[model samples]
Target: MQPIGTTLKQIRQAKGFTQKDVYGDIISRSFAIRLESGQHDLTAGKLFLILDRLGVSANEFRFIQNDYQATASELARSQIMLAYDQQNFPRISHLATRYAHSDNPAERQMAVLANVLIMAFDRREMVATPAMAQLWQQLTLTKTWTLQEIDFGPIILVLTVQKKQPLAATIRKYHLACERYVSAEADPFHVMDARAAFDLVALQLLLNHQQYATAQQFKSQLLAGETAHFTSDGNLDQQLSLWIWEGYFGDPTVAANRAEALRQIPSTRFKLGIDTLLSTWNKRAAAYHQRQK
Candidate 1:
């Protein structure tokens, strides 16, 4: 994980393009230096042009970040699946507890997924004792349920009930409700709300069968709403949800839009989260390009 500045500097040098060659007349030399050093934030359009001039493909710019995120997500998913397969309630419980204390976004996502599984198979009653309830209370109080975070909830639920009759039915019904909510609402409270609902359902569908194309269609519908105008607080969630979708779908344009939306929002937390996501995508794109070479 090279700092973004170091990565930019290396790419620039590798391309044999002097700062004057790329930044000449368009931007001051000092400013260009600052940009490469990560001292100044670049606008979406500006960043694109800079990368273009540097001869770095979008995929190359994003690959490492995406690879990191994918690894974390897969690791979390694998752990949950392992616990489920072994019927290791205690291990699951341990993971869930560890998850509660973790600040890493990736690990937190895994914890949420595990809890969903625990809820579905073991029954909420299984983990609903006073101890778990206290943990749940803490989670709720943190107000940390972002769109990416919520994706794991339904996944855990779906996986837990895969072999159970009544529980599976219940999980399906909940997923259907979420899907219907996305399809029926003309204007959701926030775009992220709709996207979150859509992702939850789509993820469940994918889990049931390897239906990538269908899931992608559902994803397109989510993307179509990105152009809708939104206020800072009013649609931040929607935009964030869309950011997650764009990240997974490999759409740089959507990622740009998400970055712009985050800039518009006033909250530090929102900005930080969006920035991390954008950086991840940019690096992911870079990684993808590198693989092609």
Candidate 2:
């Protein structure tokens, strides 16, 4: 990988920003020169400050530095759903092992996350691992989570419900982050893009765990009285997901038709998730009926 300074220079130049523009008051021109020349390394504080000036995320800069391929963390994350859709345990296990020893903390976190995802998506029981304990500690201790934390935050929730642990704090943190993201003032469009995902994940998990009141509250918030908070009203994936949830909580016929609609679309990623949710609803309903008997 090229030096971070080299990456900064390339992005800065490509964006037509001078050292003066990007380093503006953040660092001296002499310091900037050394940074770009690879003579001086940037401290984390200054690196983030300068990165903000250049309008690039730390991850994005790293991607540019790595010759434009997705970083190990990014690649693992992107493949997570495909792994779920195809039930590719071996593929995901390979990913976990491949990146388990990375020097970068993000890559390592993704490795643990991959392991956790393998268990969580399959809805298998888990004995909490040291990695999971550490993940929670970090989440609880950090007042403001980074994009990575927010992205992986729901796995903790998924496993939390599976383990039948207390949900108050984990649920609170996930909602606060999503709440922050959906506001008009929220920046970092990519992170803002994750708001819907956090909502959907939390809603599904809450429903799966029979936290009906909490799940309905989330559903109400996501709908905002039928307004499209996440997208224009035309988004079929969102509509189907909401309908499926509604079918479970309210109208079965509406939900079935929505699921059928998604099924008819052979290429949609939403199909797998919706099918899994319907299965969850069926299991939960059967258990409820058994309890009544």
Candidate 3:
């Protein structure tokens, strides 16, 4: 744990505030000195007053206290993203439950997205939860979205397709509106990220609809020059899963073998989950082959 007193002292020095300067209207200079020296305890109210004088929020103070790696909110978002990618349903559910009612708007939005994904992944025939239904309704009402919401495009599209939710038309209709919301021109990284998201979503939507020929054409475009251009592990998972579908009815063995090879590689991404998925696919493929023979 960081020493709060030391932290306060450092910030005071950085802000060019002497003990007398910080304590003028609040406490005595002697008390301030004692607080800074850890000779006296600072109450929460006094701490807030001091922080306000220093022009820092309690959240910002927490960030500094943690050595500035990431703010608490940021860490929570990362945890959710990692769990989502890993397809850890239990973890996702737990996170969704927590963030659904979070005071933070960003966290609440993430929670809605997580719940949507859970419905998609579950592939059940049940109706959407009232909360999820309302959230989706809100999202559909406007094309304007935060970049974080836009990043959800691919997953949302995939889930939409899987659930046969009739969103393809709406998405295409507002594609321009969606583009207007992005402020990526100033950031090349965001530019690439937005492009990748759109491409992945469009391709997956096609694949989900069993438009294999169309998906293949899109895949060709993605792999035109150097296929390695799309090296993200998530994209790799999508590609392999598509291969499994393509070969399933005929010679699924080919896709299964490819998956097995990928699983054996130490550098593979989504290692455990991918391996388990592939192992399961391989068994099904083998059974299909035996039945055919």
Best by lDDT: 2
Backbone clashes under 3 angstroms, per model: 21, 0, 0
Q: Candidate 1, after superposition: displacement of residue 117 in Å?
A: 1.0
In candidate 2, what are the lDDT values of residues 1-293, reduced to their tens digit?
99988989999999999889989888899998998998889889999998888888887888888899987667767876467545577888988887677888777777777787777666567667776677767766788766666777657676566556766567666657655555554344444335455555666667666776676566665654223334531254356447646655667677667767666766555555556656775676556546657
What's the TM-score of each model vs. the native?
A: 0.36, 0.73, 0.54
lDDT of 3: 0.61
lDDT of 2 at 288: 51
For each candidate, the alpha-carbon lDDT, in order, equals 0.54, 0.68, 0.61
Off by over 4 Å in 2: 12-36, 40-55, 85-87, 97-108, 162-164, 185-187, 224-237, 269-293
lDDT tens digits, residue span 150-261, model 1: 3344553344334332433433344444343343335343433534443444443442343444544545554444334334433554455556455545577877777686
What TM-score should be assigned to candidate 2? 0.73
TM-score, predicted candidate 3 vs. hidden true structure: 0.54
Order the numbered candidates by lDDT, best leading.
2, 3, 1
After TM-score superposition, what is the CA distance of residue 63 in candidate 2 from its true location, in Å?
A: 1.9
Pairing residues by index, what is the TM-score of model 1? 0.36
